[model samples]
Target: MILPIVAYGHPILRTIAKDIAPDYPELNQLIADMWETMYYSNGVGLAAPQINRDIRIFVVDSKQIFENMEPGEKNEYPGDEGIREVFINAHIKTLNGDDWPYNEGCLSIPKIREDVYRPEEVTLEYVDENFESKVATFTGITARVILHEYDHIEGKLFIDHIKPLKRKLLKSKLDDISKGKVKVDYRMMFAK
Candidate 1:
C-alpha cells in the first residue's frame, strides 16, 4: 500500500517521534508499505512522520541516485552504489567531515528542492527492521540521505537549514502545500 504522504505544516511533521518496540503492531506491514510508498513517489528516502506516523523510523534506497551519477562527475559520491536500508530509533552519534551543499527534495514537501549543507560523514546508531541494534558509519550520498531522514524523526525539516530570506521567499509555496494547493503526482494528506 502506498500511504498518503503528509504535506508540510502538518502537526505530525513537527512532532518528535517516539521509539517503537520489537512487538509494535504491524511493523513488517508498515515497513513494506513505506517501501511501496517511497518507490511510488520516486523518493530516495522517507520517514515515518511523512506518512503521518510519529515513530522513529525511516527508509533509504540510494541505488537510483547512484545509478544516475557518472563515474567522473564533479560531485563524486563514493560507496553509495546500490545501498538500501531501514533505520529505527536512530541516533546520530557524531557528524564528521566538512559541510557540503547538496540539492535536496522531500516527498512531504513536493516540488520544493533546495541546496542544504550537511556534514560529509555521519556515525549513526539505530535498529534495523528486525529490531537488531547496530552502529554504523555512512558517507557521501548515503550519509546525506540518512541525515535528511534523521531530521524528520527529530522534528526538523531541511528548510530550517536554509537562510531566512530563502525560506521567506518560499512561504506561499509552503502554505499552499499545507492547504493541499500543491500539485504532486503521489497521493498526499494535507493539514486540516
Candidate 2:
C-alpha cells in the first residue's frame, strides 16, 4: 500500500517521533508499505512522519542514487559505496568527518530541493525491521541520506539548515506546499 506522504507545515513533521517497541502492531506490514510508497514516489528515503506516523522509523536506498548517476560522471566522494537499509529508533552516536554540501530533497516537500551541508560520516544506533538493535557507521552519500531522514524523526527539516534569507525568500512557496497548492506526482496529505 502506498501511503500518502504528509506535506510540509504538517504538525506531525515538526513533532518529534516516538520510539516503537518490538511488538508494535503489524510492524512488518508497515515497513513493507513504506518501501512500496518510497519506490512509487521515486524517493531515496522516507520517514515515518512523512507518512503521518509519529514513530522513529525510516528507510533509505542510496544504492539507487549511485546506480542512476550519469555515465562518465565522476563519483564526488571517492571510495564511497552505497547502502540500502531500514532504521528504527535511530540515534546519532556521532557525526564525524568534514561537512559537505549536497542537494537534498524530501518526499514530504516535493519539488523543493536545496543545498544542505552535513557531515561526511555518521555513527548511528538503530534497530532493523526485526527489532534487533545495532550500531553502524555510514559515509558519503549514504550517510547524507540517513542524516536527512534522521532529521525527520528529530523534528527537523533540511530547510532548517539553510540561511535565514533563503528561507524567507521561500516562505510563499513553502506556504503553497502546506496549502496543497503544489503539484507533485506522489500522493501527499497537506496540513492546511
Look at candidate 2 and tell me the lDDT of residue 119: 98
Q: Which lDDT tens digits does candidate 2 get at residues 13-100?
A: 9989999999999999999999999999999999999999999999999889888887554367665667789999999999999999
lDDT of 1 at 92: 92
Q: List per-prediction Cα lDDT, in the order shown.
A: 0.92, 0.92
lDDT of 1 by residue, 1-192 (tens): 999999998999999999999999999999999999999999999999999999999999987787777767525765646469999999999999999999998988889999999999999999999889899999988899999999999999999999999999999999988889988899999888
Q: Which pairs of residues have clashing backbones in candidate 1? A: none
What's the C-alpha lDDT at position 118 in model 1? 97
In candidate 1, position 107 carries an lDDT of 89
